[model samples]
Target: MARAPRIEIARGTTFDQLMLWLDDMLAAFAHLPPDKHGTP
Candidate 1:
């Protein structure tokens, strides 16, 4: 099986919700140590 590995919002999802999720993800990453950012 082949597929692009990425976060996929389902069809008909709202743009605002996606943006909010992305913002939260960024915030979570911002506090991590530099070396911990590469995987997981």
Candidate 2:
């Protein structure tokens, strides 16, 4: 599988920050209906 780019926006950040960012991004994607990509 292809991988996304790894950007280091901040150095020495806490794990919580990273997890929050990932969760937010995932939620944003989830909001889009599956049909957007013709999945169904």
Candidate 3:
């Protein structure tokens, strides 16, 4: 997957930081198989 370039910002989370946070959040369910039933 292509990722956005990191940039230093003085506001809220940066793009990289947001991506990392998202990755961490999703990591909990990474082991689960794809939803073939599509019913989450």
Candidate 4:
């Protein structure tokens, strides 16, 4: 499964700010599992 990146830009958002926000989101996303299927 592929998780789509979620980015929200506000009116006062700057390029650098947006980049940092994306970086944070990507980092957080990377920490999550791609799928959650398991068997007992």
Give the winner by TM-score: 2
Residue-pair clashes per candidate: 0, 0, 0, 0
Residues 1-40, model 2: lDDT tens digits: 8987977757977899889889998888878899875655
Give me the runs in candidate 4 sitting further than 4 Å from their true place. Answer: 1-8, 34-40
Give per-residue CA lDDT, model 4, range 16-35, as digits (tens): 99899889977887777667
- Displacement of residue 12 (Cα, Å) in model 2 is 4.3
Q: 1 or 2, which is superior by lDDT?
A: 1
Per-model root-mean-square deviation over C-alphas: 5.0, 5.3, 8.2, 8.3
Which stretches of model 1 miss by more than 4 angstroms? Answer: 1-8, 34-40
Deviation in Å, model 1, residue 39 alpha carbon: 17
TM-scores of the candidates are: 0.52, 0.55, 0.42, 0.51
Give the backbone clash total of model 1.
0
> What TM value does model 4 have?
0.51
Clashing pairs in 2: none
Give me the overall lDDT of model 3.
0.69
lDDT of each: 0.83, 0.82, 0.69, 0.74
